[model samples]
Target: MNRLVQQMSSTPNRRRRPDPAAGEGSGAARGSNCKNITIMKLPRYGALSTRRDDVAMTTIRVHGWPVSTWTRTAAMTCIEKGAEYELVALDRFSPEHYALHPFGRMPVVEVGGLVLTETPAIACHLDECLGGPALQPEDLPTRTAMRRWMSICADYVFHDVVRAIPRGRPASAEELAVARTALERVESLVGDGPFLAGDGLTLADLFLAPQIANAREKAPEVLDGLGAIAAWAAGIEARESFRRTAYDPASV
Candidate 1:
């Protein structure tokens, strides 16, 4: 038997209770909190379906906390690509998390039988495989720019600036200064169009949108003087994909 198949076959069946605070229309059953929700069952490897000659149906499974920004980034990308996925919530510090991600990170994606860790890689893989509106720009120069901004968000904005705010830690003066500089840079990156990489929404937008929202919630001042960035953020936030996968602490 294949490794993934053997693993799934031997896994014990379990039930999950929906979070009560998960709001209506958010897909959480209203009364499910008091009931047992069966864990989603995946077909065995041998039983996987093929629609045409050699094309098998795509199955995406996301493992992470619903409220995690990285998790939400992967979820939003899945949504944008029109791919349906199963979200398997896991405790970040648990052995199970360490098993999937050596660094004990959230939002690992399992597609078919292949596992992909890290949000940017997962998002790009889904975009390529699923064949939707391309998330990355087609032009090489624009694509490079998009990748650059994505790196900035992951390295600087997310870690140095937005990290403390979500953890309930106050931003130190130095952190705030760094964040302000990053925001100004981001503001400058915004062109005449709404998205970060010119007119079209790219992987960079998906990567930064959650972080920007978090900043808005925890440190609105980081976005204070950036009119263009605020407008860009508003546009991204209004997207259906972002709305569906947006983080809400109350819902967690």
Candidate 2:
């Protein structure tokens, strides 16, 4: 066994009392149950100065609701990078949330006391900090391509398909048609491989998964004609990260 796991196993388990100051329904509130805590020592990565020792580590705290697609993106990024994190459920309109995110976004990442907002920025920062399999391609052109897809997922696919599928409302025919066109565009961009950018998964896949998952749950027919997208979504959904972070409507 690795030294880290051994140390974790040997350490005495201690119950942590919930901080009353964390507010109701926060991650800290949920963690009030002593049994919920798991002690694992993880190595530090990304943005750490060389001056720090190799064994040094930092905590990653994610504040968001699981139902939010953007929040899922940030949480999945951490999972993909093999970093342990705490999910703190916060009301977006709450003053506490505004303090963390000026724009009142759902996901706000706090790592080692540093706060970061916006899905793309937070995901990219976590990817950099955790230093595992690279989420963003190393080459400039491929990286640019990946970023372009990310933008498309955010600007077009998400707005047209994802947002149009209301929680309890049946999708309108016009809405489905627009969503199909966006899905077709996504299909055309996919190469003959498992992921969107290429053979390996990238930030593009992470960006699209939550939105796609929402579509799959709400309007399966909208994705029927797009074979490439179906296949890509299948592989992405199979990922442990997706399974861990993807939203389940039944649970809501």
Tell me, by TM-score, which candidate is best: 2
lDDT of 2 by residue, 188-227 (tens): 7665467766446788888888988888888998888787
Q: What's the distance in Å from true for residue 137, model 1?
A: 1.9
- What is the Å distance of residue 160 in model 1 from its true position? 1.9
| Candidate 1 residue lDDT tens string, 1-252 | 222223333656454342222111212222222112211223453442222221126667899876677788888888887777889988777887777787888788776445667676566656655646777666544554566666777777777667745446667777777778877877766654677664677778888888888777777777887998888788999999889876665664
What is the lDDT for 167 in model 1? 49
Q: Against the unseen true structure, what C-alpha lDDT does each candidate score? A: 0.65, 0.67
For lDDT, the strongest prediction is 2
User: What is the model-wide C-alpha lDDT for candidate 2?
Assistant: 0.67
Supply the TM-score for candidate 1. 0.74
- Report the lDDT of model 2 for residue 183: 82
List runs of model 2 lying over 4 Å from the truth.
1-56
